[model samples]
Target: MNTIPVRVVAAEVIAEGIRLLKLSSQDGSPLPTWEPGSHIDVHLDPGVIRQYSLCGSCTDTSTYEIAVKREPESRGGSKFVHESLGVGSQLSISAPRNHFTTSTEADHNLLVAGGIGITPIISMARQFHRQDRAFELLYFTRSETHTAFRDELASGPLNSSCRLLFGLERDAVEATLDDALRNRHDGSHLYLCGPQPFMDTVRAVAARHGWPDDAVHLEYFAAAAPLDAEPQTSFDVRLARSEKTFTIPADKTIVDVLREHGTDVETSCEQGVCGTCIVKVLEGCPDHRDYFLTAQEHAKGDCMAMCVSRSLTKLLVVDL
Candidate 1:
């Protein structure tokens, strides 16, 4: 991945287990401007790359701020940020990319965030405020001590349009969602970012309220759930440009086999959380395992995540 060098200008604990890092261009020049809901791949070590949503305003191109929650089951990324990295640490980060975004043309926007998922939702809320667009934000967390950006969200400007709820059980959350989504403004779009289960509940409530799939949006920071329990089987892959065919064994992934055979495919989170390895599928059905693609896209069967997803057909003719 192409990356730009940046130095951490500030580092501080934002929430109970979350740390905020402010990174500025190493050359003291303006950085790339990014939209809300955008994220960048930060290379922490030689082979440690993780994607984090840019949380602060896009209007300020001088620096990018992101919040990293120390995952108890972290593979490496969060651990490094919490233990090894600090102010003055230099790192390489990819240019911002936004797969999750909303149209400002909407008459109203309803934003829902869960725990660390607030990172992206807050950004969108800020952008909406700047655009003077009608919007409301619902932040759900365990308690006040575990929430990030509490002061900001509780103050003027955002506080008027945002509501923070803590210690709500699933039933209560559902009831609240029912109230919030029951009578939404016309042309209102719903944005969701959070734990999969929480988003699932919100989605269920929204669906019950008659929200269409097109009017609902979601951004996932982790894999939705464990991979399917179905038995694994080998499949065939054909490159459209080279007309080359290869068999992907049950034990191996398409990218693994392709790279072993000298086919270049870029990937970041090979676990299927990130969409870095998504590729076009010209033929065959893909057993989509990634949270990066929507269910509608999965039904379309036009692309597949080569890193972790597998094919459902004997042969998959794909764009290299």
Candidate 2:
């Protein structure tokens, strides 16, 4: 992944435990254009990188904006951004990459955002509003104070079509979702981002309502759960191009083994939420442990996230 140095032009707290950052190129050049749902890999420190969605205007090239929510149990990235990074701080970031892209073919778009997951959904809302497209936004939060971009959602163009569902009981939220799903317009597409539990609820509701797999899109704020829950066994990986074979221990990752063999693979979010470490699989089936790929993509068995994913077969061949 190619990276460019950027300076933090603005950094301020937007909501409880959330900070909004505005970044621009150091040379004062227009940054690369990115579509809604695109994210950049922020290099917080050596061996510390995190993926943040680009929440700013897609058409704007002056600066790229992202919202970072400090995780209490964070492994360091969010904590670093919230406490160490400030205006004028220099940072390096990878070019924008989109794993969760919006569908322009839908006649209507339904956006559901929970907690800090509002970042990407709000970007999509802005794009839809810009094109004068038919859409509605349902934002769920614990309270008004916890809602990020509250002012923007209320005063911005999306306000008219946005519904703020704050401090609602679980049953109430379910009812609201049920009603929305019941009244979903024809040719409408659903986009959702939130905590794993929230997303799972929305996905289950959508599936029960007969929404097709392709019609419903999802973005995870973090790994759903621990990726090492299942027992792992040793496996052999053969690099098709390099013609080098390496043994990946049950406790070690493919990326670690590859790097040990002098193969440096570009990787971010080593936990597998980011798609940065994806590589082609020339032969054998991958375990498909990453949250970045869709079910269809995983079923194809042609690509794998080398960071945390492993081979299901005894010997896997990859196109280094």
Candidate 3:
């Protein structure tokens, strides 16, 4: 991954629980041009890395915008981004990457967002609005007060094509989904981002409505709980580039095993929400356990993020 050094130019609380951060390149030139739906991995406080979607408009070239929601259960990064980092603070960030890009091949677009998962989808909606494309947004949140970009999504040109669903007011999102599915035409594409159960329900309902697998795109913020709770067997991992092999116990993650062997791997959000520990998979099949990589890439086995993923075979080879 390409890495760049940036300095925080500004940090301000934008709402009750949301904070916006502005970061500029260290060299003072234009920052890397990122497409809609792109996100950068931020190395925040010590031993912490977090991923935040770029919220600034693509027309802007000098700085990137990201908003953070402080979770009550946050280990550190969110609090750091909210309280520690300020103007003139230096940090490292990964180049922008995207797996939720828009597809022009679709006849129409249907976007579903829940809570903070709205970040990338909002960027997609903005791009579609700028290009005068036809699309509708279904944003569901606990309440309008906690929803980000509420005014823009309600009254702007994008609002003309959007449907807002508030959990507090309506008590159920199923009616909205039913209407959207009924109005959805053939060749329409659906993009979804939210918690695991919400995505799962949407997927099951979409399948029931005959939505093609190829027509659905999703981004997740959390990994689904393990399907099986059986203890895993111990395995060996070989680093092909370093010609070194290490034992990985069933109870420890690959990240823990690699770190124990003195490998230089950086990780944050050990839950697999951050992509900092991503590495190339030289050989062996990977049992993907993260939410970072796309479904297509997961199938190819060309790469795996060591932070949360494990090997399927008895011995695995990876590029450190």
Best by lDDT: 1
- Write one digit per residue (lDDT tens) for candidate 3, span 1-320: 46789999988776568888899999998888888878888988655778888887877879998988887777787878877888899998888877667788887889998777788888889988888888889988877777888888888878898877776333267656766776557879999887787787777778778887778888776556762244576778888888999888888888797777778677645676556577888778888877777677799888887877787888888886
What lDDT does candidate 3 reach at residue 13? 72
Collision pairs in model 1: none
lDDT string, candidate 1, 159-276, tens digits: 9999999989999999999999999666999999999899989999988988878889888887756664557799999999999999999988999999999988988767776787
Which ranges in model 3 have alpha carbons more than 4 Å from their true place? 168-171, 182-184, 224-230, 238-246, 255-270, 273-286, 292-305, 316-320
Better of 1 and 3 by lDDT: 1
Q: Candidate 3 — what's its lDDT?
A: 0.79
- Flag clash pairs in model 3: none
Give the per-residue lDDT digits (tens) of candidate 2, residues 152-238.
898877899999989888788888898888766669999999988888888878878988888898888678788878889999999
Off by over 4 Å in 2: 183-186
Root-mean-square deviation (CA) per prediction: 1.5, 1.8, 3.5
Ranking by TM-score: 1, 2, 3
Better of 2 and 3 by TM-score: 2
TM-score of each: 0.95, 0.93, 0.82
lDDT of each candidate versus the true structure: 0.91, 0.90, 0.79
